[model samples]
Target: MIAPLRSKKIIVTRENAGGKIFSKKISQYGGIPIEVPLLRIDCDDRDENRRIMKQLDHFDWFIFTSANGVEYFFKLANKHQISHEILNAKNIAVVGEKTNQKLKKYGYSADFVPTVYDANTLSKEFLAKFQNPGEILLIRGNLSRDVLPSELKKANLSFTSLYVYKTTINFKSKNLLNEILQREFDFITFTSPSTIDAYFELSGYLVDKPCVCIGTTTENKAREKGFSTILTPKVFTVDAMIDIIIDYINKKEHI
Candidate 1:
């Protein structure tokens, strides 16, 4: 039998390491992966972030929206010599399975994860679970959406945002993306809103190709950016995105 993604030229727009991992997975299924890393992720170790790390005990709940958030949060914690044990006193909530898994890597587990892995769902469910919850801390990147925090404010819940990392456009990848776009590709994958923004910024114009988004938020962003054909899996992961692409290809072949 042929590989599911055989001969498919798929554009991967994740950051460096993540793009490599995603490209390998695409190649595993016989896809020709074109890696155009659009976003650069770096730990933000500013004094304010360090100060927040030092006061981890003030929050009643800790919310992590992405794996990068979890990773950088713990990295800063370690840099400041903050004990991981301090997190045991707070309830940990994560947005996705990947974030939850990343948390586990630090010898911690999420106390809550929403049924649907999105900020809106997480906020709604979190509010539902803890009607009278105490102060919350949102561990996030620079470009994290305000949906969750806005929701918390609407419910009159107290929360503080701790930006643990910064995500910026990878200008070095612009020429590479332009060179790759000269050729024909089948599908493009976007993992986050920042990636989508970076693509438009670098590429100047959007390609008329089917786009696979990692989740509803990304899909919504793609739609807003005038991408007509968008595919999003129920599960918001790179693996889920690949599976959806395979299914889309299979269905197209049958038709």
Candidate 2:
């Protein structure tokens, strides 16, 4: 039987002091919300954005990795007075289902999205037809892995990256940490690698409580930061995390 979920608090450390949607979900599941933001965003460079948008016709695909990346890309495009038609390339790619919706908001549907959100899965699926493609314009944040770009190069497909934003530590959340650490929460959710980094920055040890992660990447980050046992949803998402956490609670009760 599933264990009762009541009076359990899970902290969602969103990058930009933004987790309203996540907080709502946790509350719906009987989990109290704690605000401990880990990172903040600032636009780093935009010069390369103009150069690419001006030559938009030269690109075969415009790929996005995050909702943040998609938001900033369109923001920059709109800022420079670039036409919406410039974004209609032969194809478009994104990392997650949510990011696909972000693209839809810009009036251009994404052509490719992974069933599961991750760099390896996204690249393998993209490369199937990417070998015959022309240059691709990969829009991402300041820091990201070279795995995707390197794979494209090996397949002889050219691609250029346009970093639209920067992710920096939110050194302003020290007061928030004191409140969070003083009170022990029932569950802690790690949504990104930076979130895990921020936890250690404040307290050397992770909380002695249940931990949930959105994806394997975040799961690994949590495990590295002294969280030995973490629950990673089979599907990487906030909704998926709920389903998995519910199931895990039941299984642990049986034991």
Question: Using Cα atoms with residue i matched to residue i, what is each candidate's TM-score against the true structure?
Answer: 0.97, 0.91
For candidate 2, write residues 32-101 as lDDT tens digits. 7786777787765567677877887888888898888888887787778877887764588899898888
lDDT digits (tens) for residues 1-255 of candidate 1: 899897899999999989999999999999999999999999999889878887888999999999999989888888889998998888999998889998999889999999999998999998998998898999999999999989999999888999999999999999999999899999999999899999999998978889999998899999999999999999999999999999999999899
The whole-model lDDT of each prediction reads 0.93, 0.79
Give the candidate number with the greatest TM-score. 1
- lDDT (Cα, 0-100) at 226 in candidate 2: 75
